[model samples]
Target: MATWHRLGLRDELLARVPFSVTLERHQIAVFLHERRFTAISNICNHKGGPLCEGRVRGEFVMCPWHGWEYSVVTGKGPAGYDEEQVPSFAVEERQDGVYVQTPPVMPRKLVKHKPSHLLETHSKTPGAPPRVLGISTTAMDEANPRFSTSDALLEHAMAMARELQTDTQLIKLRTLKFQHCEGNYSKASHACTWPCAITERDPEDQLSAVYEGLVHWADVVIISTPIRWGNASSLYYKLAERLNCVQNQITIHNNMLIKRKVAGFIITGGQDNIQAVAGGMLTFWSELGFVFPPFPFIAHSRGWDAEDMQNNVRQVKASAALREASRELVERAVDFWKMLDQNRAMMDRPMERAGRKANPLVNPEDAIV
Candidate 1:
């Protein structure tokens, strides 16, 4: 038997035609397709894609990753696998808000294993401290023609991150001589093809292993890039391609290398409008499960002219609003890291001893198991 649940208001649906909400024990995704509101589990039965983020077609929710489609009304996959139905809940629209009645069931699996450090009891506990991670891209250094405002924004972001006392990683994409694209659609073949002998000859031009390690170790990352022709510089885009490769590897192993890591964006451009660059980067972050901050600090009127960069730098240094924005971002990064630490702590407990169990498939170690 099913019961009706109050999910949200009708007005809220107007803002997000397709959105998701986590109830007492279920991750429910709501969708508005063909003038009707439908609620289904956020988890995909096949690979656990967030159905809420999927595109709403005429009558189905299309998974963004592999094109898997599910009927909104029935919560069934396109292939008609009778046993593949996702749990559906009864929903109601009242007072311009929507609500859902879910079928009580076991709690959904925790996203990741909590880190052990968070569970330790410390004497003289102080207030929660902020955690920050400064990230720098080396696209501009490579002198790629596509270098744009995003690179400059990333540089400023790194400086701000340093001011916040966060860990920092500077990634120079040109240094990584990695081969193979795996299965990226953008580039059929591997992007880097430099021979090792040549790489050794110009070791300085090689990618930095320390930086890559830091990226894997950091809790939060702030990415900066320059805009070129209303988009990220070519070097940044290439770096994005390599990052996607790493992401794919992590996914295959089921590792949580990127799980719970907060992402912030900094972009700079010649033109005042930065929507195109910011939008593209935001979309990438969202797809990767990154929690993006509310505002993206985009600096405009930046160019190759050292004078222009210096002038913009002066304005940023003088403006109180810029300072406040930096402080806010640092604070948010800290809070996000704390929450992640707590959650990781929960996962560190010995399941049998703590009276809690987890899906072995989703466990960090078991990701490769």
Candidate 2:
């Protein structure tokens, strides 16, 4: 037998249309369009985003988390995605109140999507030479490039890695066209998925190259960035923000994507604050399960008042000590990676993540150890 439950007074419910009400264990979203009331499941089919909190788009509701759309009335996705539908309920407007029926008239259907290629497991090859990836986060005009202090140091580091008989690759952030992070994790912890929601949706996102290098290809990662106004470059922050998906896997799931990998840094800039920049970078990579080599970073700065950009470039290019330090940084990373490879069995154990986990959202009495 079907049961109808009163939601609220008709006028009140009309004003608060597209709101969610929990009846027993069912969460239903109520919407009012063209003087008619409709009700559907409040949970989004994509990541369980609250549909009631989403905005109405034409005849559909767009999920706030990742923009999955579904019909407000029929609870079906737009056009070709019609197969992906949410359950809809029968709604009635009485003189006294508004009511929604249990046992939805339509049933929810989900489309099975193949897992993203970035989600594939990665393993180090036995007896294979260590691979080093240099990420230059110094932004410049790619069409007509200018000399960057950070890039120069990074290039020297890559050259040293090659000389050390290790495989090497360099990625310049200025060359790649990728979108900034949309903060899906802000909506919900589970919403920030591995492989990144952006990478899954857009095939042209070049951040996949960086992800591929860090997660699958490289045994050692050396990040080079120029300090800007006492901080790391804007490009570095953009890359770091997008990398939240990587660190979040440890927070939500106990999965650590970066394991037995070594990380080092090259910091160069006209402005001061090398220690601050290196500290932040060290903390972030450490949280991602990357072990740092001793003396893991090399940096150079002209100081606060030394804003002669030309001399800054000239100094970085002309400094043999700085160049030698860059080489040494990569050498340290390669040596550390070799040690980790040799002790692969001991290092492969599950990471100890007791104090770093997010607090579970549950009643204290209902919590299980």
The model with the greatest TM-score is 2
Candidate 1 clash total? 38
lDDT of each: 0.54, 0.87
Instruction: Candidate 1: list runs displaced more than 4 Å.
Output: 1-131, 138-165, 172-205, 208-211, 250-253, 296-320, 345-369
lDDT of 1 by residue, 80-198 (tens): 44345667776666675666776723322322423222123322233433435554443544544543334444455556666767656656454456432333323211211112112
Alpha-carbon runs more than 4 Å astray in model 2: 94-96, 351-354, 357-369
Per lDDT, the best of the predicted structures is: 2
Clashes counted in candidate 2 amount to 0
- Among all windows of ten consecutive residues in candidate 1, which has the lowest summed lDDT? 188-197
Q: How high is each candidate's TM-score?
A: 0.44, 0.90
